[model samples]
Target: MKDKKKWIIGISACVLLMVSVFFVFNQGKSNEQVVTEYFELLKKKDYKQMYQMLNSKTVYTPTQKYFVEKYKEFYEEIDAKNIQIKILDEQDNVIEYLIYIDTLAGRITYRNKVGVKNEQIQFNKELIMDGYTDGCKIKITTYNPEKRGRILDRNGKVLAEDGKGYSVGLVKGKLNGENDYGQIAQYLETDVETLQKKMSASWINDDSFVPIKTVSEATKNDLINKNILGINGVKISTVSIRTYPYDKVASHIVGYVQNVNAEDLKKHKNEGYNSTSVIGRSGIEAAYEEKLRGITSGKIDLVDKNDKVIKELCHKEVKMSPQDITLTIDIDLQQSLYNEYQNDKSASVALNPKTGEVLALVSTPSYSNNDFVLGLSTDKWNALNNDVNQPLMSRYKQTYTPGSSMKPITAAIGLETKAIDPDKDLVAKDKWQKDSSWGNYYVTTLHAPSPNNLRNAITYSDNVYFARSALNIGKDNLFKYYKNLKIVEKIPFELALNKSQYINKNQKVSDQLIADSGYGQGQILMNPLQLASIYSAFVNNGSIYQPHIVQGQTKTWIKNVFSKETTKTIKEDLINVIVDENGTGHAIYHDHVILAGKTGTAEIKQSQSDTTGTELGWFTIMTTDEKQPILMTTVVEDVKNRGGSGYVVEHTKAPLDLYLSQVSD
Candidate 1:
């Protein structure tokens, strides 16, 4: 009986619809006016008035609440408040109206029909809300977000940018059969079972629009060409994907963006973040998130009991666009450095000693930033995390023994303390013994050079000369000089910089241990960046400028840790290290530029008790070009019974050559 009644009501509704069509064709002034009133009510979102004007002759008419919800669902992406409707024609009481919907994606226009009779209106709601079922009426529309900011090098070369992409989603409960699912999978270039599994995890019901996967433009185009986007339950949306054009070239510096996780969503909820938001996870991306993230806006709709959108209450447009960020790094220089030392476990940092502007910093064994942005598979992510080389660790921040590099710092301390004269000969030998009060400790020289004054001491990297100088200057005075240079303190900068370690304040240090510190061994460890900044004082008239990686700006000078005269005297000694044939770094001398550098090799003991251990080669050089001066520190780790500080000088020459060529151009 119930089925029969429903059929009778359906038949009655069809008959009334036919009559309303005929009445609409008569073209009465009252009917035309009613159509105008219905659209006017729609513009004001006055669902109560719009529902009242619908023709009541139909036996299958929906309730007022459901009626409004259906309209809300139909115009989900549109700003109904700004929607403009105009009458195109009214030849037969049938009014053809044009609806203009302003959307973030673009402006959309479509035609809607209205039938009028006796000051009443009737229209097929199904035409506007396709595939809408009677029981489900809630609607949701995603607004377009502004593109993420571009990351550029100092020279305005794009390092990272937003690229066009697509996201595949499923409108739950809309699929008809296996054939429909298979067709969609085929278009996505995936098997039906794989696509089905993804949908199964995200699926809810007919009302849910669950995103299944993100695809490239090629996949989206393939699906579009196959006409699969029109398939029921399948949805496709264009998105802005974070793209790294240079890939892993500056991976550690530029970083990458990824979709917000549940933890981040909860933590950043107050900041207007959602599950769909993309955020910087590390490096420059994390350091300057506020400037890089784009504004997002969308419309909010209210639904009725039958899951229909009753009103589009508000529409918000993005207020701010993404801001472009420029880094001080030179990508060309950075890539050149990376390629030359990619095989070795090493790091190199190049900066303008005068301004403290970093030109390039390279840490080898880097992983691809693109992989992180696109989302890393578990296996790939694990491979990187578990790799022995620790590709993710930024060697720029890591600390290492300065080796004989500390000799320069010790020399400056000695000059300041009046412990050594610049021209005085030290008579360097192969070995020097510590005093009986300091225990049985003897310092050995790499190669003994006769008439070793401050100049030859630095040129030959003589261990005994520095050891004797450290004893003369005293530990208290040496520690004070290191503190004044801020060598062991955390550097002030945007990126994370680890602090160097010094001898424990309370620990008793014998004279021999203090002598070891002078030769760049023992307990002292120096961060590459901090060491570079301190070395800048040698070229910048004894004043250390704050180290920075952003272009077009100069960091403030911390202080003149060494006097101008002291630096001038020390610079001459440093210059001899490159010009003197007996110097360890003399092999790296170039005719186009004057090079002043120091080379040191410190043993990395496996344990405190293991005196025999692997060596770490260290080299710091200043390419003294009047127009563009570059100071760089290169360290080669785990050099076991192999080439010593010489290898460091070899690697340093490549970048110096590249940098000089660029400057010459």
Candidate 2:
């Protein structure tokens, strides 16, 4: 009896639908108005209102939540905006209409029909997508995976690319028992017994080319020469891998790729990433990941409730070719900087002051990015990770005290705030203190020149002069300058940089600390890029142009942070630092080209009384010659015992001379 009643109800519903179809003849206008209202709601992206107008009693009708979610998801997926709808005609309870919507994929127009029942919309796949049937499945077809994008220099020199490397193989069956496996191990700088144990599996066949290790280019040639039939059984095989052409020269800038790990999979979950995928680990590879990876191309298909062969919904996938990242770096200059500072624990950044493009970035004791891509052994990986010089670290992004390089900036701030009279002399002595506030510490100058003034102080790197200048500027006023210079706010950059800080977190700015910071010591620390940007302000009419690595439009991070007069004053003083015979920066003076610069020696110590401490040498310079208007900031560790800031000055001159001579305006 229950089955009979259910059949009766089903028949009754069919009858009602037929009645409604007939009823639509006279109520066509009303149904058309309701459809128009439904389309209007869609145009406004009012999914809830559109769902409320849907015929709830329709068979296979989804829940209200699902109804709303589907519409929202479809619209969002298409990035639909600026929707327009028009009625075409009316049929037996079905309204034909046209819709034009703007989507992220671009503008699209389509025609479809929706059934109107009792003045409510029959919302289904047809309403969502033109000509697509309800209760259908999308049969997705994936396009073949393409190569990840190449990292290139400004002139398209490959930095990182998809390439191949050779592996050293051992055919166990061909190896004579008395042969010198120890000799091969010695060649690889590895233990012979361990190498033998790993390759000596019982399942080895005669034809098996078991890979012993990936050999370096130098080692691969030696292995190829030694590949004999019976003795060592060493064979070389080429395997595909990501390769860094410039290797350690561009390691910190180009970075490297590695096979996706659990963490990577988890972080990029459901984004078409899997175990076999390789993700960028750092540099441009990491920064422009999605762009380099390219979009997945696929097709959508429509099906019915009973799973029948259906028409294709959409034929083409959203195909995006893997985009190459072109950096603004001049690779030759990058190499030059690397060659100049490779021996020292140093970091350097070169920038086009006129355009704000980062010309090059170099960090010494660099590691080969290729090693990571080809795969690192436990020992090799641990050695790189545990190295004292931090071969794998990116020092360009790390913060170091700007030292006396901060003097010129401090002078700018003081001049801007009217705290210093540029023409008048500062009463800075060889040693001085502010009221001797119960302490044994005093602000001292490295070199004492009679009648110390702004130009003389900068020329001599008079620390006491700048210390008194900071006191005159005061905390509030000094911080005001820092805020304008982007020193307070984080500078927007693709690669992460530790923000330059004036003091430790939550630490109050004491008088002594402020005085020390005035000369780039105390708690003040600066990223190489930030210091380069700050130096750029002098040549940029007192506006700091933001430093960018990727090739693109130049933008100013802050405009007019310093007045033109103030910039001119400081800029001239910097030039004097290089031009004057007595200046600390005169070591880099050239007869043909005038270079504006400042030399800094920042002391690092646990306490004021600590005699055992290290000093970082900093040489920051901008070209005064119009034809070569670039600036660079270089900082090297342990310059205290080796001529202090003079070490950096002497090393940077030749490389920059080469770069300037080769580059045309």
Candidate 3:
């Protein structure tokens, strides 16, 4: 009985051992088979089968058709005939394979991962099954799409369009100097060195097919007749490159575009930007980037190893059409203002009095927008960036002491708070003595003998009168009224802005400081935009209108800050600043329209000299005939000849005359 039991145990042990060996052998064979299948599929140009053999769990299933379409579209053009595949790793649940495909077009490679599931491998079946559809064909043709858009003036007048001008771009890195660089450079009127540098710098390493140059006016005729082999790398792309027919006339206001950079890409990545694209970096281009970046559309074709057509994979239609924007700006007025400031370091801002629409914003020392359309050279970019006058900085963002421009705002505030009666007559102490110790500083008047009233005080910009008014009203009330008018604060324009600063009411407002603050001095700084908007409020009754550059219909109206009565009283007071005969801005005044305005000369202290640097300027105005009170401001920084007499009224008159003549007529 003992012998029989021992025999049974021995047999059971042997059976268990045989079963274990068979299981191990099968597992090894299964792994080897999967690795072999992966390589064989790749060797056969069966991408779909290979994809299926990969670990499916880690692979992402494209959630959208767009994502899959992009990958499939690119892979179809790739040649898999020379592809070499190797097994990189094999674990219980993970497998990795390395693929190397070689072709004259380019070397394509990738590491694919496959997840083992129930001992079965899964991959992209459709991709492998498509095989080499293009293997039978030899000729391959590549086609790029056309660029289309319109260029219009403030009033929809076409300036330059794809239909009118021809543009051609060369594949950035594709042009070879050893074979065709010298010939191409000669044909393009550029040197080989220059072309080489441009091509090298512009080519984004990842994608060499993208055209570097945004636009070049080389026609088909130019390319065909020149016998330029480099032309083979060129592709005809139709895009609208807007020119101001009068190039430099409105360059600053119209702004310009340059080839986008890393910084621009980082800032606008979500805005659908790619390298080799143009974006509005400044001026209207920057202000209207969203509206002007037209929708992009393209056709994606699927082809095989021999570049032969496969089934049409997918063709997506982009519907981002260019939008037309009509600005309140008058092109004629903008041009005329540009002409006036052609030779000076000057800036002017003109706004519609009633609606607060910016009609013209001009700055001199401008460059042609066309220069930027073509990428700017290193030297050209340096010249503009390093210029002492800072042509790149729009003066509207520049803040200066408003001088007497703040007088009207102060006066309006005084009347509203009842700090002073408008009709009261007061004698200007021609000389205001701060105290017994400070002695006396003489105040100048329109009439030397010194006649003083609210009208005469504003017309002459009487420091003494405003000084006493500020003292009586106090700084707390001073800032309150100024804040109400949106002075001493930002006006939320549709662009990046530098914040304006004003004295805190809680800070000390001594008699001398109060006197200086009253006449636009001591501690006050304002940008041209702030002054323009504030003056607009003073002119258009008391309602502060938010200034806007974009012209379009909207569902909401900006809130009104002042009552109707306050606006009426301020309008009457502001008119006296221009039309009172003794007014400081009288030089630019006209009765054809009920024009109201003010002039200022802020003193700037220089380190080199005892004499103060002066910013000569004038601001504010309301016109009745145009049914729009125009608020205009002009500033000429560092007038060399004017010592203390820098308050020359003519600087402001130039832009004002240009604006009124165009709009009033």
Candidate 4:
């Protein structure tokens, strides 16, 4: 009886175990459950886990490395973001789902199906629902790059243009490679080995641009000057690249271009910039980079193993064509001005006083901007950057004392405040001091008029007349007129200018400082741009035209900075400064063009008694003829031993003459 009871208990335990096994097999994960896990891994970009979930049964299965690389490369190139997946439907062992991916190129969305086999997902190259890159590669299709815009002058003279260059390279057809390698190396200034490897390129044809080293116009001239073109196989060819026609003539205004570096890549990430891309480095090129560069348009393609295009996966249509930029500058005037001051450390600004359009902006001792375009050699770059002359600096944007140029402005202020009576003589001496409080400090002048009235003061550039005027107007009222010139305020311009200031930091406050400033010396500063514009107020009926480099309508910046009476009186005084036989600037007087001008000299010294101080010479001139109106302000450093303000006047007359001859109604 005991043996029969034990045998029945064992059979009951076996029956319970069989029931549990059947229940577990029937409840195995459905297709939806398994595929959901696979997509969860996909959304995370967990390639390893996602690959592990893919079954090996499909012919479309790619190796783990290929899969990971494809996703990474394509996704990175597109700047993929915000991936999402949702189950759509299920049939048998297959599960259908919608996948959405956002990319820099655009958003991608599609419906895809996946198979679940034994709780594992089947691989489908078309899983993204876009045609799978199978037996094909991801191909990048780039359009003809937008032609970078040209920088043009008022008459459409091109200063900087795209798709033009002089490429100095070897001509395979002409290369007598045997005996000519040495001569070629010498002319190209490159070693023989580099040429050899470059020439040995399997695809080299007679017309190939072998070595294709682009050269600046200056460098091209150097090659000609050195007689380098006589060598066998050496040739210069026109190629597609950025070119500066005038080279250094407008370098400070046009700037240059350079290949994008790591810093630029970081700053412009996912903004269509790459390592090979070129960017504007300074000047108008940099200021209007977006407008000049336009939009980068291209497409992505899926190609077969043989490199034939299977289909286009993404396409970016061209939107904005590069726009040509037209400036108010007359290239001829710019060239003429640059040439006149090329050898000096000087800055010049020329403007249409009637319209306030900047005609020319010149900074002397300039370096060729084209050198940067073709890629500057380290030695050349270092030489330019480290040169004592600072050829790279834009001098017009820098500030300096206005010297006697401040006299007219000062007289205007005095007249506005009723501090000066034009008809009455102030009875000031050529050498003067306010009182015994001035101590040893005395204000002196080069010329003392018979009557120190307003007209004679301006005509002779009397320092004492304006120095006493500063004390009359007082500091509070003094800087008020200057403030209208944008002094202490940012000048609204495309390019930046260092702020003009008075009473510099840590400067000792005293009547001497104020008196000195009255004559345009004591810690006073103004850039060529501000001086030119303020001088415009003298001719513009006591108002200043807003300065602009672009061809735009004349906009009044500050209205009624001076009354018309003050401007009319000052205008006559300035005209006398140039017209009078005894005037200081009479040296530049023209018969046909009634030029009004002032000459000034700012003494730079370490101490009040320093006799060895340098002087910055200034000459500000403008046409009084309304039909052909132009204003030019010029300054040159270290003019003490060089003729003082007379030196600046002499140099400025050349460009002024050239412009007058070229002017039209």
Candidate 5:
């Protein structure tokens, strides 16, 4: 009985030992199986299976709120149905997965770096694992459509076109080897690295067959001679570039083009800008960017690895953009005026005194359109931008003190408001002074012993007379007239404006202040264009017309704020300023036409000095014939040699001579 019991115990112990060994080995195998199965599921994009296989302790439990909050933080579009899990690699302890997600635009793949853990994974802690896929990410390639538009003169002369040109493209799958890159770069007279970088930067993984650059005939011949293998990827297409036969003549007005950058893309993305686009940077190019940048056409060409074209998958027919715009400018007159101001630092604006058509607008210190077209280098761009005289600045848009130019407007306001009588005779007496609540500022006549009457005030540009007239008209009335004349604000025109402001004054109109205001002093501001237009109204029987740089546009007429009779009275008085022997503008007078005008010199203050700058000489005039009268205004700022009002008359003679000589026939 003892022996039998011992045998049973031995058997039981052996059975128990065998069971323990089997359980230990089975557990190890089960853990290995679980890891393998989980990785396989992740590779097959079966996230649910992988989640089920995860060790219970390390498994994550997520709430709807957690996902919602995470989605908001990343600005990501997350949908349970569209989430794809792709296992990138599984090594000793770490596993990487690419999670492809569906967005509003298309599929965006993300990378998740996950590690094995024994505890439950927190959703907030795992958020950092979501990152953009680097290796598996799709490389985006951008196509920039060519800018197609016509270059036309104000008269609608086509100077350029969107036509066919030779271009170079890479085959779909071809690598740009050193020899191929060298051959192309040498032909183009560019650096090999630069060419390679540009090619690499422009390469899009999805579409690699498109032309990289448009080359000239000379470059094409050179590439052919080199027997370049990948040269088969090169293509020829019609591209539009600005062409100017007149070159430097109209460069300032026509402007030029440049490559679009990152900032430009942000601002003008909706306006049809892409990665490889060109845009107008200045002149008519900038102003008419929308019109000039026509609709772009696209095509899909299948290319091989060697950049060899296989077939065109799809192509959208190119459509001709909108018709060219017509400008109301006279080309001949523009050339003539430009020629006139070529050597001098001056500007000329000629309008059809009857219709207000800008026949010619010319500013000196102009640049060549070709230089801009060919793509200016950094140094050249800097020189142009940093020029001291600011050649790039349009002088017609610059503002200046109107000086005696404001005299006629002041006189007309005085007479129309009945504040000062037309025939009121008062001696200018050379110097006039008045004390007011604000300390006195002296008003003087340009000529000594000046005539005091309204006629003499304009004729001699007598500050005292205007000052006394300002007192008569009152500050409120002066402001009203200026506003009515569009002097206080910007006038609507195609060109931009530098707005003028009236000097602020005390509530009560003071005698001395009124005097200063009357003489075009105190706080008066006027652009040369404004002064010219106002003078035109003064001489055109009170008919104020909007000044236009474009020709053939309708004349936008402003009602005669002053009646014809009142305008006639003002015109007669103003005639003395040019026709009278001692008149301020007498030097510019001619018997062939009745030239009535005024001369003014405004003092400018310089910085850090008690000394004042030389005067800005001014001349405003009107010429009348059987047809409607023509008006003109000229200004010469900081006259070097001839200072004061004399310089104004001297400069006025040139335009007057040209106008009379050209139009008298």
Candidate 6:
């Protein structure tokens, strides 16, 4: 009887334990179901269903419409395209889940908590949405405009750098009284009337905060901290101002930045560029913009019911920092040239004859690059556009009559066609007699010496001698030589080059035209770059090196324009032009460095309205150092003097001296 009673007690105890286990298991399952449903609805963007799952007795009670909008805003704030969730753990009425968000910035993960009681769901609603919950809140913070890449010269000197600044703006409707204007003006260091005028720009409206001026980064902070500028209506924020440290020195090569316009936005929208972003407008800045622009990223916050942010989470930076660019330019050389010629309307280019590495490219009358950095004022814009000197124009792209500079090419052609002998003497006359077919055409001689050889002809720039050589070479051979030399051929430059035109094949070529062309007259127009490039052949062993401003040498050579023997002979003759007593460039000749080059004086016709004809004086000089050859070309415009090439040679000495003393080192 005792054994049977013990068995019955054991069986009843086991049954009670089983019933307790069943009830607890069902309760936990219910909690998990409600928690899972809440998150699943949130993932589906079914904010209404998610709101319904929330206990109505909750303290964080936002209306259904508000709940939906709040979630919508949260989705927008996160910039997320997708949301994924997984059950992490469950204990009685408490549940935890891992939420993964796929955003434009990157993936974001969160460990979220949910509670259940009496099978009713309860949680901090603001964790996924934004609004005031008793203990729940959401906050969004942005850490935008990370550091941008720098633009550096080949020597690693900074050319473009980020400068700390701030935009000072006023809320259109925030100014309550006249005293406000005075307070703001004092902080801005301006008069009240001027400040008012600036604030009242057309772009500003009653609800707008229009920026008036940019101040130093420190100044912006000081005003905000002291509230000295009447913060009630004033707006200030840290900003990155792209500054060209050298300003006007390398303006054309380094380029400038401007606010992105509608066109730029439309073009680069897919590249993540916005209307407010600054874009490279010209030069290297425009060319390498993709590598120079900065990437944007920000932070997001979760707020509690008391309007307090509970957590701050940052989004991963979408793009790496902009890469700094290293250019092949020598800034010191560039600046020196700018200093010497900034006031003039002329252009100069220096390059390595063998490799075609441009040492310096100067186009004078340059405006300050900073003028375009922040924004260009209308008055300044109008001035740049109206200035007759056309300061912005790069003279390398503009063609002008090359004058006697073409004599060397003619000499090369004469040598190639076997029309003239280097050792043979040719008679140079005072002037060419008018031909019956040429009508009034007459070619004058600048310098005349009897029994002039090829070397003497080039040394004295004997026009009649070259004219006779061109006639001897005949029209077809001369034309063929021009084609071989690529005189009017379109140059392959990273920068655009204007296509040069030769005498039209359809037009009749008279004897005078051929003679005039021989001495670089009568419709012979070539830019300074083109002439410099052709002249490089003399030092490059009769091979033309494509001219380039960037670092890597193209090493492009047009070979066999003249025989090695002929090239040697022609090169020596050009050397005589600088060293010879009768040479046009003899005025600036120096014994320290052996110089070889030619001088030109082209008579440029003025507008038909003006009677005074101007002369375009040109000189191309080169160092004879075989290992370190430097070639320089200079042109002076509108010279009204008979000194001609001689005057140019004298005036060009200072810059050349500077270059030799400084750049050679």
Q: Which candidate is the best by lDDT?
A: 4
lDDT of 6 by residue, 1-665 (tens): 99999999999999999999987776664777777777678777888887877777772655888777777766755666577778889887778888777754566677877788866677575356433344444454434355557878768888887886778877778777556877776676566787678766788778787776676555567877877564577887667788887877887777888888899867653345565678888877887776777555545666665646666554556465577877766777777767766776667777778877777777778877876765554567889999998878876667778888899988888888799897788766787754666555566786877677898888889988888888888889988877777767887665566755557557788777788888887667777777887788887778888887656656765777777676777778888898988778887788788888899988877542445778888889888777557787877687656467666677567767876886567
lDDT of 5 by residue, 542-637 (tens): 886787764456575576877787778777867877788877677777876776777778777653143656667766667766353556555665
Error of 2 at 236 (Å): 5.3
Ranking by lDDT: 4, 2, 1, 6, 5, 3
Q: Can you give the lDDT of residue 327 in candidate 4?
A: 91
Tens digits of per-residue lDDT for model 3, 565-620: 66666667667767766556666676566776667776665431437555555455
Candidate 5 deviation (Cα RMSD)? 16.3
lDDT of each: 0.77, 0.81, 0.61, 0.82, 0.61, 0.74
Please list the Cα RMSD from the true structure of every candidate, rounded to 1 decimal place.
19.2, 9.6, 12.4, 9.8, 16.3, 15.3
**Ten residues in sequence with the least summed lDDT for candidate 3:** 136-145
Model 6 deviation from the true structure expressed as Cα RMSD, one decimal place: 15.3
Error of model 1, residue 202, in angstroms: 5.9
For model 6, the stretches where C-alpha displacement exceeds 4 angstroms are: 1-148, 171-209, 215-238, 294-321, 504-507, 606-611
Better of 3 and 5 by TM-score: 3
Top TM-score prediction, candidate number: 2
- Give the TM-scores of the predictions, in the order they appear: 0.70, 0.76, 0.65, 0.74, 0.63, 0.68
Candidate 4 lDDT: 0.82
- The list of candidate 3 runs beyond 4 A from truth reads 1-154, 158-193, 196-242, 262-275, 297-319, 436-450, 504-511, 553-566, 606-609, 626-629, 640-665
TM-score of 3: 0.65
What lDDT is obtained when candidate 2 is compared to the true structure? 0.81
The 10 consecutive residues of candidate 6 with the worst lDDT sum are: 129-138
Report the lDDT tens digits of candidate 4 across residue range 1-665: 89999999999999989999999987998788887777677667787777777777673545778777776666666666787778888888788888787755556777788788898877777764378765666666455355788899999999888756687888888877547787666655566777788888999998776754677566678888887788767888776678888889999998888879999988876667776688899999999887888876667776788888777766777677788889999888899888888988999999998888999999999998877878665568889989888899999999998888888888888899887788888886968898998888899988878787889989998898889888998877887877766688888888888888877878776888888898889889988898888889888997888888877656888788999999989988989988999888999999888888888999989877899899999999999889889999999988989899999888888889888988853
Return the lDDT, model 4, position 421.
81
Native-vs-model 1 lDDT?
A: 0.77
